[model samples]
Target: MLAAVGALIIVFPILLLLLNAFKSPVDYANSSPLDFPAALDFTGIQTFWETQNFPRALWNSIFISTMVAVIAVVVSVLNSFAIGIGRVRGRTWIVLAFLMANLVPQEMLFDPLFQLYDDLGLLSNPWSVILTFVVIQSAFGTYLLSSLLGTFPKEILEAAAVDGATRWRTLRSAIVPILRPTLSVLMVFFFIWTWNEFLLPLAFLNTSDSLTVPLLLEQLNGERQTDTTTLIAGTLISVIPTIIFFLLFQRTLTRGITAGAVK
Candidate 1:
């Protein structure tokens, strides 16, 4: 009962936003936002697509997020396996370093990073965003996966080694398969985090070619006096791909999360 109530409380705002996005412009102004649309007027969404040219923004977000997520997951899996399962010397210190790194806010990092990239002629390049997200997100992924990887069956690894499997071969053939569901969850997290990031993109991505959905949505939202319906519609539109992606991977995500949580 408490969970259901909490879920509703969390979900109601999003529900309101979604329902209100379809409200006609006049209905938006005159009616309560919480009220259902008398008619599903899609003109706002249509106008938003035409004016906003959402495809470019959507593509940029997708590409950057996907690259960052994939890189983060791959690198993180290796780091976790080395530190947690392999029990490398100073593994504790490495884990501490990653956790501490997350303490420094991205706000501080981007200004210097921007200047550094500016010097290198890399500002506004998607790689800048991709590498930044990969670095930032990988630390957390490594930390989280460390504990999960620690749970790997020692007997299985020993058997693989008895068969003369090298570390790389064991990882590729034995460990990676076991970690797939968890890695899927981690990838989903990294994807959502990178997709929803605003500060670095806002600070460095100046060209319309580089503009992501968040940046574009910010612009559209700032024009509050303009067709508010269109703005709301745009906001809702930005989350559809994310929602779909989540739904598709949620089973793996759930399994990973629960596996991590268990002893």
Candidate 2:
């Protein structure tokens, strides 16, 4: 019963989005949202696509999300290696610092980051947002991966050392392969999380040329009269890529989540 309720809770909004995306303006205005549309309308999707220059926004989102994911994963792996495997001095303190950084609210960082970017002349660059999320997301990534690595087998490291393998070789040949499943899960998560980011992107990417999908969707909300169906349609389009991405990685994600659960 609880599982059914949870499923409905998750699926109900998606059903509403689909209904709103195709419902005609006249039908929506006159009838209840729960009621089926008398006729399906494509106007909302068309208008959003044509007027918004959605291609640019889509590309921007994809680039930023992908870069952030890949870069953040690499950074996390490096940090986790030092803290978890290197048996670095103050490892607990380092992990605590990462946790604190992750806990820091984005709202608080916005002003300092904005000013920093302005001073460095990177405010106009998309790399500003990309780098910002890399730093932000990697904090959590490092924290999680560090904890996972701390429990790593000492026997494997000893075996690698006896074989005359260097630290980098051990990490590349031994540790990474074992952690591939977890890393895949993190890549998927970072991609979707970065794609959905709004506040920092909004602050940094003001120009139409650099606007991401979330920023473009906000524009669809409009300064004056808003078209509810158009907004819904834009939202549906924005989520489709992330949905497809999740589906593609679903098996890997499942494996990653279940990796340590059985043992």
Candidate 3:
């Protein structure tokens, strides 16, 4: 069936990566890529871990991604509340501006942001990447959340107002609870997106000590003399955190995605 084939297409590369990660360099070089390895090897994984200081890279990535996701979601909810619920003046123009920002490529803003961060002494600081992505990701988040909030049941808001709930109380007690699933989806997305970022981290986190997982993967890839299996092992390791994070939030993601349809 088409679905089976599509699944295979998506899964095959992952299988390949897993297979090769366990393969010794000699076994990989001597056999076809599809062939099973002669023996399982942990050297590549161990080498990559020890040489790249993978623990530090992982911590840095987790920190940056977590900060971006949390900050961006909070900012998005506030912005959307003002535009969608408050019906702020120039709301349409504000939404349009955010859309325009989303359209603008990150590459185009890199130079200016780089200079700005440098001036602020944020170069090599994780906050540089965290702040940049918080702004960028929240633009998309605000755009999406505003549209979603626009379609939110008006009766709910009116009922809250009738009950004498302040705006902050209403948001904390009502909107957020109802929108938890959607916000969880956005948090997962922002986390993964920030985790996988390369150029932004590469530009700002220039020191080897400050490098993220993706940057470490890039460095592994660039080393011409690095073992092919070792590089694949590094790639495999880099993806594990994202996979675990996604799986942990899988139910919330499904609920968020389906909540709109069910409602």
Give the candidate number with the greatest lDDT.
Answer: 3
Model 3, TM vs. native? 0.89
The list of candidate 3 runs beyond 4 A from truth reads 251-263
Lowest-sum lDDT 10-residue window in model 1: 252-261
Off by over 4 Å in 1: 1-7, 34-39, 253-262
Which pairs clash in model 3? Answer: none
Lowest summed lDDT over 10 consecutive residues: which window, candidate 3? 254-263
Q: Is candidate 1 or candidate 3 better by lDDT?
A: 3
TM-score of each: 0.86, 0.88, 0.89
Predicted model with the maximum TM-score? 3
Model 1 sits at a Cα RMSD from the real structure of 2.6
**Error in Å for residue 36 of model 1:** 4.5
lDDT of each: 0.86, 0.87, 0.88
lDDT of 1 by residue, 27-134 (tens): 898998878898989978998998886999889998999999999999898899899888899999999998875788878888899998899888888988888889
Supply every candidate's count of residue pairs whose N, Cα or C atoms clash at under 3 angstroms.
Answer: 0, 0, 0
Candidate 2, poorest ten consecutive residues by summed lDDT:
254-263
What is the C-alpha lDDT profile of model 3 across 138-169, one tens digit per residue?
99899888988888898988899999999999
